[model samples]
Target: MYALLQSTAVAPNSLTVIDFLADFVKFWQIIVFVFGAYQFWANRRERLAADKVREAQELLDSNYQAWLVVNSAQGKGGSGGRIDALTNLARNAQSLAGVNVDGAWLVGVDLRGADLAHASFKDANLQGALLSGANLKHANLEGANLSAAQLEGTMLQGARVSGARFSAASLLRADLADLVGWREIAAVNYARLQEIQRAPHGFREWAVEQGAEGNAVSEDMSAENFSTQFRAV
Candidate 1:
């Protein structure tokens, strides 16, 4: 009779130990599930970001290829219509970050609102191109042909413009602060000189010394009439 009573007491203790183990296991399982879910979320976000980068790279590549085709067709004396079509494709490309279009023939291309920060356009022909609202911060424009290019509201801070041609280029509301080699551009007439907004310290004095004149030359000119009376001097 005593043995039977001891057995019954030990059974309850065993049941309690089993219940604790089961609960512990359940807790660990929940923790593992939460950790797994977090890992999945983190990985998914990383993948999405990588996908965006890839997409941007692909777009840039397409533009580059189209530009090359245009150049090649021109070199071969091909029909102007085909070259124009290819040029249009290149011009309308989106997300051109970190692209290298150095020495490219991109004359008259529409690059408005492009993300061209840290891009290389060295010796590229960008004459008459629409570059309004483009982000050209830290871009390399050395020896590039920018004559007659539309640069309204363009961000050119820290851009390298040495030996670049800005003759006849519209710089209305363009940011030229902290630009590298700003004094070495090919030309800076009154019209181009008036486009500078928040011009680097002493740049206004330098422009005045360089013979720029007109209503846009004053520091207190109304914004509406600032570039309206711009005349090359």
Candidate 2:
């Protein structure tokens, strides 16, 4: 205690004072540095958030403009614009529900997982197009060519496919027959579960033989009543 009092009793020397001042300066420098770093990080986060919102809004604006082109680009000499807009919408996975593009040439367009509910593609050429996992509920595909198209897991429950040939196309696990508008509507889900269209080769053949039908399942066939009624359910 006496030694400590002797060291601190009098004012410290110039060296001691300089050392204390240096430590004080370093402590505040660290505080200032930490505060500045936090501000920088916070500012960076705000900028990133703003950029994300801006990008989303820009995308929505683009889709809206494309939709405008799709609706207006009809009648004659408008297929080019319509096709481009449709392609953009499809690429963006936008809904094409109830949008009519009759007789448009959209061969090889990529429409995977697109929402095409109630869309009219009558006489549209979609040969070799990618339509896997697409929603085609109540869509009109009369006279549309879907040759070599991919329809794996596609929902086609109420799509009107009259004159639409799925020749060489894939229909793996696709949704079908809900458009039949059956009295037993609950059975529709079960029917979709055991889709005869997606049957094993042997099972399909056996069912065909049991039904005494030909190998070809016509698009005009009513799968519900096992009749030859085409168009609406």
Candidate 3:
């Protein structure tokens, strides 16, 4: 091979070899870099799109829950039949916004993973309802009864809970940051309990003498105090 190379002088110049190698390496490096950038940009775009979809789904779920509560309250009697009706009604009401279903007797209803944003549930009866992981943003629950309700991991942001009864409700790990009038209700409940515990010996008689109903518990206690009265008797 050496004799043939020396005869033909086939060995390329060193400068030519170096230039060819350098250009080849530079071209390959540019190709790799371009592909890497494309892959990075595509992945980033997909992640952003997924996040937007998740956010929209959450909002839709919240509104759907509010509609279910309204229909359950209006449709009365027939037990199983009413529940079937409610199932259909909820499917339909999901198309609308800001549902109003108040004064309904909803004991032990399972509303987990529901969305209840901007719903009006004034004076609703929701004793023992399971509302875990539910979204209740901007919902109006004024004078509603939520006694013993499971509110674990529930989102109650921007909710109006004025006069709402949560006497025995579980709020563990629930989001109450945007709840309106939460502090006021807590103070009111505390005051009512203090008044009952510190009542004078003749307070009952004095209340009656002053035209206050002797049997009346505090104003906030009217809905829940019936059991208290029964226990006292």
Indicate which candidate wins on lDDT. Answer: 1
TM-score of each: 0.55, 0.68, 0.44
Return the TM-score for candidate 1, rounded to 2 decimals.
Answer: 0.55
Mark the regions of model 3 whose C-alpha exceeds 4 Å error after superposition.
1-97, 186-233
lDDT of 3: 0.58
Report the lDDT tens digits of candidate 2 across residue range 1-233. 99888778564676688999999999999999999999999999999999999999988998999988877755443266776687789888787888888888777678888899988888787766778788888888877777556676888876776566554455556766544322212111101122434333353343233332334445543242321121111
- Give the worst 10-residue stretch by lDDT in candidate 3: 186-195
lDDT of 3 by residue, 108-169 (tens): 56667666678766777666666777777788888777765667677777788877776545
Assess the local accuracy of residue 153 in candidate 3 as a C-alpha lDDT between 0 and 100: 74
User: Going through the candidates in order, what is the number of backbone clashes in each?
Assistant: 1, 1, 4
Go through the candidates in order and give each one's C-alpha lDDT: 0.71, 0.65, 0.58
What does candidate 3 score on TM?
A: 0.44
Query: On TM-score, who's better, 2 or 3?
Result: 2
Please identify model 2 stretches exceeding 4 Å from their true place.
1-11, 76-78, 178-233
